[model samples]
Target chain A: MSDTILFDYWRSSASYRVRIVLNLKRIAYRAVPTDLLTRQQKAPDYVARNPQGLVPMLHIDGQDLTQSLAIIDYLDATRPEPRLIPADPVARAATLARAMVIIADIHPVNNLRMLHYLKNEMGQDQAAVDAWYRHWIAEGFAALELMAPENGLFGCDAPDLTDVCLVPQVANARRFELDMAPYPRLTRIDAALQAIPAFAAAHPERVKPA
Target chain B: MSDTILFDYWRSSASYRVRIVLNLKRIAYRAVPTDLLTRQQKAPDYVARNPQGLVPMLHIDGQDLTQSLAIIDYLDATRPEPRLIPADPVARAATLARAMVIIADIHPVNNLRMLHYLKNEMGQDQAAVDAWYRHWIAEGFAALELMAPENGLFGCDAPDLTDVCLVPQVANARRFELDMAPYPRLTRIDAALQAIPAFAAAHPERVKPA
Candidate 1:
């Protein structure tokens, strides 16, 4: 069978993760962009594949996969050579734990729509909204910084799952010009990640949509 | 190996998933409640196990497993008896996809603090905020309902991983008294799930955390 296709949007961090994983694994697949700006996600066809109308849905031989973490893990499971999750169960758990710090804990708190809600609906001033965004990043990063660096170079130098989730969030933080000075370890690990081609190549600007 | 200990708040939808899984597996776990109303999760020691200081930290064989999805999957893998995840590669992707729709899509957008911001800080009345809340749930549930009935009795059948993640969100939706009429299929599955002892016994009130 031929390779699977990925539905993506360049700027979406979730889509960015799938792109990074596909790149890291050296997988050949099509990247289809669903324009977020045009509100295409809310369109009938897009909602059929992903009810939530989110990007980064992977169609592997036709079955649609939602959720970046699930998609990433599925990629790892199907292509196990450069394992994204570590071998030891505990370390794997730790890696996932760190990922949760970013995915479940931090990213959810600072997603695009939430920020919009904070500004348009919550009447939060730009300053308060920015603070709110950074506050969550700082909180999760502090914990991740505390726990990461189990081995050598990157965070959880098994160079596993959590690190994949981390780099994008760090990039997003940088985009907002959130000061990373407070999160020493997270910044350290993120710096290490920046040196890797896999992370750099998968950046949003480099994606097919662009 | 001894059973994992789960520190959870009964009413916390995140914690409720683990309780359901443990029951499904017939795996024994002692439930420790972290007081949400009192903000006990913000306590120092709780912060140590979880840097994010969120409830539903699963202590398994001395390893503190945070993130409900991570914990649930670990059990699904290690135990493997009742297999919450589907076995075929494609089916497995679908299962993960369903779970992610609820976990990544719906829950994050409607979090406690997020809703609180709209209500208290943003000065949107409760009516507007509830509409905002149900809008997301309806968006997600509509997609889930369209899935093959074999996926669960609710969305897919017999309550696989997606259902485990889903039931709690539905519980929260009911708590908010969001109009459940729009998604009759979801309510049908909800009824199917509530009838099962495993899900019924794991309900928030069953946990007895005042």
Candidate 2:
């Protein structure tokens, strides 16, 4: 067994993504929390580990993988117990592409750093910032809702990698109280995925810190 | 022969990524420029193809695929001319993780919409806005510089998808006059890749509206 450690913050959706995947794979790992509230992730040591100063840096056999999607893909490829990504090219592309809809297009637009700039530098109040965040989530999810086959269960069948990434990001959206009425397909899919033990058990509340 | 048409804008690094992959694979494609500055991508007809209103959407046999990395990966999978992503699990993860260091983390943070907010809504001037763009690029490239293996070429033994993604973003970095001097590994690799036909041919200048 490889010695694996994950430096994570409890509330980070990015960290939340890895947690869901590890739980699904039943990978036993230690979680060393970085308190995001105190901005400890910005500290020098943490910066050394991840110069990007992000959360959920997975130290696998001393190799530190930074991006959550890359880390999860690595876990999927290495473990392969219950696969996260699909096997087929077109299908896998769809799975990964839908997942990136959240990771690349939507999430970054609302992250803490962007919010910090909006509030501190831009002089926007909390309401405006919240609106900005909700706008992008709604935008991305709307497209995802339409694209979802509605023909398959859990991110278009039986809980794949896209399913793993989607739940946490949607959970973040829920925390922000974003209106989900515009995205019925996503909400329905979210309901289905959360019903499964693998996803539900990895909720932020279930983690040790809480 | 497959009917492949790439809807692109010359200056779009996202489109440029696909262009490089197509050239690397020696695939025949026709470039149909979608002028982004004129709100062409947002037109009802174009939006029908891609709801997100983004470019680098590839039309192959009537199906359109958006998102640069997704398109590139699709090309890599279907045509094995020049493999764009690593086949090894660990190594592939490192390559993708390194690539996402730019695609996921840095690029979106400075996306056109995000920059729009930094200027119009956030009240940041050109200098502050340029600083903001460079800040994330520098932070991201710094990590990538460390991530680039010395013995390995182009973040791996061969030029992979990560390298394809890296070059365009680095070129964008140079546009802002960002000092890439600090990140020698990336600058070195950029030099290496840029000198090649695929890279040189995919130049934004080589695309339309230059």
Candidate 3:
């Protein structure tokens, strides 16, 4: 089999989400850390490969893919054993919608570049920056909490796309010290997913470079 | 066929993307204008239906779908005549990645609520808010311009998901008075897309409630 290469940052929520899927599928690949703090993703060579210059770019099957959810979709499409996205149309739409609550609405606003812009360009202090971060999480999670099922994980017996997206964002929420009291369902789901070996192995702290 | 209803705001870029696909597929539907400016989306009743309280909540196939891309995915899956998202895995990933540069990165950061927070909560004047809007657009567009093909539309002969996403964001850029001189490729693509009847009919101006 050809080698799979994942260019990712350990601390990136998007990257973390991809890692969980890779681990869940047991797809062995080399992890090339693209440090976002130092802006290594913007290097000319990296830009040549990924025009967006974003991390979590995967090179597999001789194709270079960008965007976390897109990459996940590609992964799910090719590796169908433990499906991350549902195959049924309605089920798939529900899963994608819940997943996008984080991918589109919450994560983008709180990602490193956005935070950097708020602090450097807008002259916001750390407190304000943290507030901005928590604000988005609060808004997104409130809806997600409502959408979350009362029974099992996001995929209801197994982890699906929403579960993959949720773990990383929940990790970020804790990193920013956002309160978890209101999102009991999410907090509980995160806890259950964490106990699963695949999700646990992909934690940012576990993968962080020395 | 059952009735198709879309709860969307005329000016919302996310809502606009969904509109393009619905028109392209020739799906007849009722568009209920959920005004963002008056905080109509945040009303208790709307929130009950769409827990996210976001525009472009679609009702079809006896299901309520949120998130523009997810809704679009559902549409493409059910209505396969003019595929907005590619069926081939590699092509789908590339299309989705390009589309997400706008969907996930640019639009979310510059959405109505984000702008409202900048002005009201963060005390940013209109000028600062406008600069913030232009900054994200410029960053996202620079990457998208690189990914855009030199020849045909985003899908070559027909408009795809990337084209669906690009037209609305380009509309937003023009609304904000952004200088489009740098992104010649994107400008060319947007112009070509707008010439299509499906793209033209989805314009905010055409759909805006009187």
Against the true structure, whose DockQ is highest? Answer: 3
| Interface RMSD per candidate | 2.3, 1.8, 0.6
Q: Give candidate 1's total backbone clashes.
A: 7
Task: Give candidate 3 regions above 4 Å deviation.
Answer: none
In angstroms, the error of model 2 at B54 is 1.4
Over A116-194, each residue of candidate 2 has an lDDT whose tens digit, in order, gives 8777765788988988888778878877876776655544557887678788889889988988888777788888888
lDDT of each: 0.77, 0.81, 0.92
TM-score of each: 0.91, 0.92, 0.98
Off by over 4 Å in 1: A1-3, A120-125, A150-158, A208-210, B1-4, B117-128, B148-157
Residue range B1-210, candidate 3, lDDT tens digits: 338999989988899999999999999999989888788999999899899999999999788899998899999999998988999999999999999999999999998889999888888899999999999999999999899898988899989999999999999999999999999999999999999999999999999888
Q: Rank all candidate structures by their DockQ, best first, as comma-separated numbers.
A: 3, 2, 1
Best by TM-score: 3
Chain A TM-score per candidate? Answer: 0.91, 0.93, 0.98
Ranking by lDDT: 3, 2, 1
lDDT of 2 by residue, B107-204 (tens): 88887777776678657799888988888888788878877767555645568877888889998899999998898888778888888898899999
Model 2: residues with Cα > 4 Å off, grouped in runs: A42-48, A151-154, A208-210, B150-152
Which one wins by lDDT: 2 or 3? 3
